[model samples]
Target: MTTNDPAGDPAAARGNAARARSFGAVAAAYDAGRPTFPSEALTWILGPGRGLQVLDLGAGTGKLAAVAAELGHHVIAVDPSPEMLEVCRRRQGIDTMVGAAESIPLAHGSVDAVIVGQAFHWFDHARALPEIARVLRPNGVLGLLWNDADTVVPWVRRISQVMQGDCQTVTHSGGGDRFEPMPILEGSNLFWMIEQARFRHWQDLDRKGLRQLALSHSAVAILKETRREQVLEQIDQIYEHTARPPEPLRMPYLTDCFRAHPSEFANYRRTLDSPVAPHL
Candidate 1:
């Protein structure tokens, strides 16, 4: 099975893989610090579907899976990390499994839709695209979601800079390009009818919550002990200097959501090969 590690630069990709896996070490903090998906965003992705069988691929700590379950979807949550899966299992509705995006554990043509939230960038798209297409039914939907800080707000911009170390990390992390059409999805024949939407939302967080949020990031989570402490201290200073007297400060976000359906070719192929009659 192909790993989620990035390609091209071997050393950098290995470091990224290690960084990606580092989340399990701070899984609890991740769950606590991460903001949940907006209901409107979920509604847009679901698109009038009810009780759909949905797979949450790369579902770290069940954040998006929990939201999907609440919306009455039959949710299956999958991730590579056992620690992340453990947290997911604790949630009442989701069925948790240990699996990577490139090699989903589910049977072929089973799920009505596959949703990936905040983790699609880590996927090896060459392998994962085929796997995702395999499990999705004819005309099945593929949704991608990302919760990004709205740096247009000056304080939020400054805070993001502090967390990211520099503006380049923000750009490299797809902060600016997330809302645009994804190259992998756009260039592929597997998916057609691509659509995009942005939902505005904000989270109320205190100084401690802000610290946890910073720590929840892979870049921050992978930092060495003393360096991590220094980063947190910098965040603390930023919060102290900018936040008002109110205990909970407003942190704005833009939830970028994109959805696409299987291409006509994909649907036709599935129809010809399917053991059961095509649903679409």
Candidate 2:
């Protein structure tokens, strides 16, 4: 397929194709295989904007919620998958809610801050932004984050190419680097925090486990089960071709975060039109 205006409409195309991109196929593996954000990065995104209560939007497998809770902030975790939520529920003293970023289940202006991990790219930002803006208190903040493999590593590059399927370009744009560009949301998402961090640790996962992690991505989630199985087999070949010891391999990622607030209207409109963050 071709488009007349790919540059002006990349995001639109992404959104249109994103619905079928499955995120739950490897929910369990995602929880198990995905790395957590670094302490310094978390501090950068949320430390300065500490609030009375924090919400972790798209709190997949409770990764962000875990860190948010450590900050001693009252944290609420929200996601659309029961399987993913199940992993989050394992965390003690954590509040887990079943909701989408576009339709969070929290009350208006009821949160001090909202943060998301590795999942914001999957959201319909045009709608999610306004929804998020409505829920933030005056100068309240919103944070977004993701952990992507450092494919600059030769082996990692091959692995990504094999598993990314048809989405390699869209998903791996800019070398899988971390991004927190908040300007796109200027009218809606005002900048509050900007940070970049990297994690170099590795996990011991077999070809099957590594394949499972890729399958969990929303992009791969759109494939038919049979075709997905074929993708996994192909991924296995790539893994075998790359691994030296030919056993479980470790994956490394650089995590990035973006924090911002809802844009406020003019001085006169503020008094009557001050927006309230939504809870629904």
TM-score per candidate, chains pooled: 0.90, 0.78
Model 1 C-alpha lDDT per residue in residues 191-276, reported as the tens digit of each score: 98889888999899988888989888887887789988998999999899888867688888888889998887766666666653
lDDT of 1: 0.81
Error of 1 at 200 (Å): 0.4
Poorly placed runs, candidate 1 (over 4 Å): 1-12, 170-181, 268-280
Query: For candidate 2, lDDT tens digit of each residue in 1-280?
Result: 1212222367755653464235554568777656667766667666744435888888878988888787677888989888788888998768999898779886667787788777665666666766676566776677777666777888778666666667654522224423334444553433434434444445567766777666766556677888777877877887787666755577766665666655554212333545554543
Q: Measured by TM-score, how close is model 1 to the native structure? A: 0.90
Q: Least accurate stretch of 10 residues (summed lDDT) in model 1?
A: 166-175
Q: Which one is best on lDDT?
A: 1
